[model samples]
Target chain A: MNYNLPVLLIAIPILFSFLSLILGSFNKILSKIILISVIIFNIISGICIYNSVLKNGNILTVIGNYLPPFGINLISTYTSISFLILLYIVFLVASLIFVSKNDDRADKISSVLLLYLASSTGILLTGDIFNLFVFIEIFSISNIILISIKDKKLSIKGSLKYLIITSIGASLYLFGIGFLYGILGTLNLSEISLNFDNISYFSKVFIFLFFLGSIMAELEVFPFNFWISDSYAGSKNYVNILLSGLSSIVALYIFIRLFLTVFGYPTFISFSYSLPFNVKTLFLTIFGLSVIVNELAALSSKNVKRILGFSSASSLSLILLSLSTGLKNGVMAAMLIAISVIISKPLLFLSSHQIMKGKGEKNLNSFIDGFRRNPLFSILFIIGVFTLVGFPLTPSFWGKFLLFISATEKISYTTLILVIVVFSITIELFYYFRLMHKLFIKDENIKVEKTKNNFVYIFSGILLASIIIFFSVKPYFTQNIVEKTTEDIFDKSGYIKSCLKSGEIDDR
Target chain B: MMIDNRTLYIYSFIIFLIGIYGAITNRNLIKILVSLSIIETALNIFLVSTGYINGSNPPILHSGMKLISPNSINISDPLPHALVLTAIVIGVGTTAIGIGLTIKLYNHYKTLNVNRMGDKDEL
Candidate 1:
């Protein structure tokens, strides 16, 4: 039998999410087993899809026998496959942590986790615009449930805010889709891209704004990110991992895909026939402002989780800054920064669960005597901090180095943006160092609790840190992968041609 | 104004703005949810309106329909109808989740006013 990797990648998890729920009522352990096996199967299939794409170009799997432009299809490229693999790895590590802990709500959490994975994977693989919206809704709903798993007042409020704001954003996006379908009469992404040039300038700008405004909430940008700090602080560590690792990456991917491919650079339109505003410049300005705002928020926040949330938001804004450049080098730099952030942020979040063992408070004071309790975790936390701050010998350092180099190569208004970027980094370093100093300070009044070092925390933290180290030591390997993914992202004509071809084999 | 395509769009836009106004200005949680539903319904109407033609028939080919020449008959676009169905379903799910959370919040805070639900100081 022919194996269809893309369909199986999505279908397996969705199938198991329900199965796990049913099995959970009977036996929770059996549900956990089912969840793990499905994840492992997804990982293996993701690798197979990646290898196949590398060997035989892009793979397109139509849902039914209908041809492209008529049937919904799943297209897997190098960049998407890389994201898929990263998502699987992160989910696997997180699941291990979940299993090692004993909670009364384990069965419910496991099922929601599976659905989250499935929806995110669907977002990554779908080739139609409407399908993307559907998956995004599923992703948001599951995320709301995940955040409110504890049923605390704080979690409930956070989830409520998230639900209301995101629902509004999704409706705005659906409105934009209605406008697009009315004008182009097609929902397929490739078909839309093909006809995008024919749209009037006013309509183009309106559609772009609508889409940008909607996605900004998910990407955790300036205006729509008011609830981020609360959500991050209220949720559990594992849920934070899912938020920072999987959800953020998927949202960023969608942003990049929509901007870089669908309403792409206006090559066919004349340069002089500009819209009322320059979208590229507008994006850069927004991202630049977001970077400064996030850093300042992080500096003033007393809660550690809120600080981390702001830092993650700042990192996302910086990546968006690079992407706004609309050049190949800029795309590569964005990918590099994205990878480093994805790897290091989760490590910091996971290790914090161990580092802040007995601290009932999430403020900076909790870290006053942290080093005395867990020296190893403190060290790992410091390392993760250094990586985020772009110190030498870390993946973030190389990523930032390339970003600055690319920014300088442009030699335009980006110089001012670069200055803003550097100044924000300085602001970030100030609080990070303060936290570090707090960690190492010796205080006799502080009672150091002997926190048990669980295998799950140490294993996942060490695994992620080691991976970061491997990438830092071998920058060339990271560079090569980023370059290939960048190339794949920018090849719009190739994507359109490959997706629109008729009568392709099912590869099932 | 007579009811026309332009009129439908105008009315939907007005309703959408009203919803947004209510969502921003209202202090009650249930009112905000109702406003959100209003916005959703307005968008659904707008989407379905996009597929409507002045003189077109429903996009169904009956058994007695002949394979006429191209452009012989005007038929409304069915894609947006299908899309609106999906959007309505999603809207219902979102509303249910919103109401569920509102109930829980009311139970905890003893008030439906968003401003009365103070910031959570304790986790």
Candidate 2:
């Protein structure tokens, strides 16, 4: 109900991360308690902020009373708060999976997870551009640490590659921010968006390209995503959930915020200077290529996690493709698809992790007789895979439906992209169904060991599955939020006014 | 005689490009990490120079100093200096992590060259 809630959302996790580290030194269980309690607190605060934003509109909390356009501020809009809630839920589930591990470094992992939560919350809430860069670095560094913390050779290699790529991306992004700061003399996002149009066309294009290059690397889009498959496959199963589900969502949020709102796409197209090429067409080609390449890669990959990694890259790219259409319907579709990913990715990884327990290798044949051994988990896996492939009674189905509808309304290269997307989806279908078919194979030749069932995995799987099924049973439940988030993203002027105005909702 | 901002900009850009080239081309992990740090330093230089104003006093207030106006100030912008400090701190953190990981990696593969790490991952 108060304006300090945004700061609390970021600060609490950070404070507790250190507290968790200290407490874990005394008793490892204490650290797990602190981690869960902090995530629960985040969910509660997120609900309060969501309620307040619904009543009072976007709330801007300027830090240390420095005021907007001069000081750092956190903006809690409809889109960001809802995603914060989703991320908290996912983190809570992930922490549970993480807590159940038998590793001696559990305490340290808890602290890292809490730090990841804090940085992600910061990335979502901050309205300052340089602050966003800082949060992104924290986010990426934490990810690099998590990927290799187990010290497996494969994971260390993956982590090394991630470190190099992200470091380069962050440097390029900072350079872009510097370019903008030199030109506009401000780092507040709303102020930049307000004054973005006055800059010379060349500077605008250069800055945009820099921002795009950096974010695409972060977003795991086609050209700059060399680190994805190795990192995804090499990390722990729970870590894969955080990487594919939470981090990609936050990066996509940044992409939308910077490209659609701050740069003002309408102003971009309406520029009187003759453009070098069509921006929308460029976006469509990039994302479309990602979709095609990743889907085809997913189809050919033998490793399950690698397949999921490639699938997630393509799914996020499809979301980007829909977004490039620049229609309200397209944004709505993107929101639905993102929600599907945020829910289903964890379920797939969690269930598959359970199914693969006691198996020597994480491959397709390992899934044989999965239904006979762990029926509930196999069912959950089916739901997750179906949701990914856009079967009926799933949010992804509706997302793809809306995507097709929106693409048809445009009736141009979008249709061509849509055709490519549809072709990719068929490939997606071929692979996911192949995975599902492995689950049901009645293999009588081999004696399967009874793997110990992790109740945490089962409980989290059911929880995530029910969320998907709930959304499927009641599509409108999610649509209301998705529609509002879409509007919040597109309302660039409203964002500028709220951010630059001497805060009406300021706590001070 | 002073070098203009154009030359400085070009210099930083060239440094940035060199870092990128080394990062992409180097097969040794430590070399790649060094390239990344080079890139970070180049960015910090670019950012600090962006806020530099010729012949302007550092952004500090003294007694009897006249303000340019209510909204605009006569002193050089201090924000980029603060930003570059934070960026340097972050760069240090990243570099430290890179070194730690490299140590772990060397223990595993016994080689710094990425090409010699061999294909542990397969299709």
Candidate 3:
């Protein structure tokens, strides 16, 4: 059956996202049940679609018969499918966490929550830049709302701050697209990428800056994202899970689409040699620096979520660093890290929520007696922290190994990289062991009663631990999928031929 | 382009710069909002400018200029303008939400200055 799967996966969630909201308002139990069903269905269908695409090589679910370059299109290439599957998994966990007894806004906030998922998933699936903008707007607005779901005064303030900054960010993104369209006269990504070389050199430089202007806001790397702390700090844990997990993934997806596909290495700039490095080298250097800066801030952070936030951002910068290499290996490393963040971050988030009484109380000492209070969960949390820190045999260790090997192989400068990796790992290990030691040893040894672990929490415990260990051992489990995905992305002639010469435009 | 060529791009950028300046420097809640509006306006103008056609009318395609130079066939790109309109409505909607929040915040904290609005832990 010609299932038109791209739009189907996106549309189903989109519909349920709204349906879940309405359902939650009327019957909370039904809402939770339907929401879980919808997410599970999403996961199942994503796998089906992914398996189909894996066999077929590429699947384009063009919206309403729209063709490429001119008409809006949605292509379900391998990477996006992989991303969708990851997204659904995270969404499933998030759904569980949101519907669980603890979250304050789970019931009240269900309306827009599903919509946010649809928007983010839609952003990942769409083909045209303008449509991407639409989804970005939707995702950003929904994200801001989701962040503020707690309805506390501080939450509202933080949401507003996020809304203003990201709204401006989205507008700037649109405005930049405006110029790209002005010069190239098309919003279709592949066509503009082809035509990019023909544009003026001055415009090329401006366009590069335009990419920086738009993506930097989402990257939250430095000066552009000064609001990251204020925005991410006080948000509810589940929404922050979405923010750090799915939303960041969506943003990085857009960055990859823009940076790699449209303008990987523009030849028009005359002063290219002015910089001592190539594009990939630049990605390595800049992101390596962010590793230290973010780690330093993360170490000093008092709020546990903010520390996770910083660490997420820190790890995110490393992924970007890996991507800067512009090699298949680098992309492989990036995808591995992405999967790690998707799985492990949510586990940690749920664990953190379980461990804490309030937002700010999740200090190092809080987890001192965690083993006694909830031994299973506490052990799972340690595994999660170990995974994050890249302890040997964990999936992250392999991912980090790939990143290190890729960087060394690509750059091939033994002394320089030796210093960079050491410093970066040191910076990472410092905060990690600090938090680790705190978990293991503390002056205030308070006794705690054994609380009953939720079935869902136990479920998450089993799921994340296995997946962490699974991918760590067989890196090729995901590596094969990601490698195929990157191969598809780099297939330029295939895309152009597929778009322009696909016989009758299969506009399903 | 429908608009003067230089003004279409340059002015929007200038307005964007002004909005950024205001967002960074302004201490008043309302003023920052006004600046956000400025930024949105600039972006809207920029989005629409990409769709403009020189000496062309809106993309009604009414057979009004069939005999005109088809090579110079000018129809203001309706797609970009439509996207811009959607963005403007969204801008208005988010702004309204922001205003609603600000009102709540002002009532609770009794201040319009964002700096003075919240406690250390909450903010």
Candidate 4:
């Protein structure tokens, strides 16, 4: 069987992660070198793979010499490849953040970071339902370990919470897969959808619960959102950056795949045609309320991490709102918002952490006196806040603009209502700006205390913020490619042709 | 005789709910970990049992049993078995790591419970 570019893209990371384990991924320099080399190699490979996919339309790669739905196929439609490429950037930036002049654990943490990238990238590209489960488990395992590398108490507590809580969520997904498999007799999502015109009510129930549970954990929504706040509040700032920014985006990507490709549940993906009052209205109502409440939570938060946590929730709501659109515009908007959050959140995390001492908890007030003395930091923080708040000219502003406009075209009243409810939460900005006002007002009084002026830390934060802005203007920088990736979402024949063909697959 | 598939599913759901309750309410980290294991077990059982038919043998083929036709053995589905084995490995890894962390946490915090570990600001 020929290798599918997308499957290979997914395989490259997992393959390296496994090898790193054999060669000691977490404790040595040799392993760290291997790990980084492998990721860089894959990133290069992903670039080429993405190019080929764009030119050829789509490609499929089957594992174990078997055919589709049986052999565990990996389909590289545009979206997964786009995410794979985006993930490489996120992980690369994160690596720069972790490496430092005085970082003793740099070797070990970089190794784990590579594994995180592999698992997350795998999540984006895998087509088999069971394979997706394996990727999710890998992601949870690697990330829990990564969080533990922070502070002793923080690591232990956060890791345990992450491990146990996410394992429960993963179990739900496994149960759902079992239910789906028993009835449909297949583990491939594409095949399952093709085989059954409509699933039984029982299967529907399983699908709804399983997908919701898993995505809920990753997205940090209402039910499972409990774990992430403590994590963000407790873990080192850099770790929180990885969790809030990159991890959640990958999870959202997986959610979109499941929502649109597998379940095809119109409840989430918005359609252009008139949806029935109860059908469309109910879902939007709940999603809209989530956006409002999450914004309010972000506003009310006292701790910096908790504030970012709530901000992430708001971003999650926006992406969910975009996905609920179900139209072409919705898919594009989802990717844009996801890219925005993942890129900007890291900038905020690393910058805040660099400013504050490695304290157990991070509060907005923690950085008081910074605005007046450190205009550099002040500018970065303001830019970070601006991006988070979706101020004009930021990545999120454009991202949310696309989503709001797409949403309004179909359901103007719904969009207006959500926008108003969300705007009301700007009072929360008082909490953040108050910190800024304090820093600026007290600028000269406080001294820059004992701190590590590491080049990597400062450089990483600046680099992260710069990338955020760069993408904002020329979002077409990656947007051109990512949006191109979304176009292949409905191209099922491209998957089937490559899967069924031996050498000359019709990659139309 | 018809098997009660519906009853099997109800039983599975009940087990899952109990596991969730135990996980949420339990105080000890090990006990919470055990509850998580229960949840994993319940999910695995649901997956494996879903692969079962009224009358079927394990999917493995004995050397002497290849005499006649391919379809007549009433072979249980092998896919869930493969999937479950992976799940089991994953579950063991998570539990092992959790227990190790709990032990470390106990040594550090002087308590196996979450409440005492907090406010230490030790991280």
- List the candidate 2 regions with Cα displacement exceeding 4 Å: A265-276, A502-508, B62-65, B68-74, B121-123
Can you tell me the CAPRI class of model 3?
Answer: medium
- Candidate 2 chain B TM? 0.87
Q: Pick the candidate with the highest DockQ.
A: 1
Deviation in Å, model 4, residue A163 alpha carbon? 1.9
After TM-score superposition, the amount by which residue A361's alpha carbon in candidate 4 deviates from its true location, in angstroms, is 6.8
Could you tell me the lDDT of residue A32 within candidate 4? 60
TM-score of each: 0.96, 0.96, 0.92, 0.88
Scored by lDDT, model 2 comes in at: 0.85
- Evaluated on chain B only, what are the TM-scores of all the candidate structures, in order? 0.90, 0.87, 0.84, 0.82
| Candidate 3, superposed: residue stretches over 4 Å from native | A102-108, A265-278, A357-360, A410-420, A442-445, A506-508, B1-3, B67-72, B121-123
* Model 1 lDDT tens row, A1-508: 2336798888888988988888889888988898889999999889999888888888888887667888798889888999999888888888888888788777888988898999999999988999999999999999999888778888888898899888888988888898898899888999998888899987888788878888887778898788787788888888888888887689878987788788775342111123467666788888888898999999999988888888888998988887777766667777877887888788878877677887788888888878888888898898888888888866677667767777776677567667867987799899999988988888887666766798878888899888888888898888888878888887787788878985566545
Worst 10 residues of 1 chain A by lDDT: A266-275
lDDT of 3 by residue, B5-43 (tens): 567778889999999999889988888889999999998
Against the native complex, each candidate's DockQ, computed on alpha carbons, is 0.77, 0.73, 0.60, 0.65
Report the C-alpha displacement of residue A74, candidate 1, in angstroms.
0.3
Give the whole-model CA lDDT for all candidates, comma-separated. 0.83, 0.85, 0.72, 0.69
Residues B1-123, candidate 1, lDDT per residue (tens digit)?
235666777888899999989988999999999999999989999899888877788888988766687467677788889999999999999999999999999999999998887775673
- The candidates, ranked best first by lDDT, are 2, 1, 3, 4
Write model 3 residue lDDT over A1-508, tens digit each, in one string: 3657667666876777677667666667766777677678778878888888778766766665556666777777677778888888777777787777644445446656667777877888777888898888778778777776666776777777777777677767777788888888888877876777788777776767766667767776755554556566667767777878887688778877887767764232111112223554555566777766777788787667777878888878877776766666666667777777777887777776666543246566566555556667667777778887778866567667776776566445334554655676677678666665655563354555665778877886678778878877876666676677667656655555555554476433
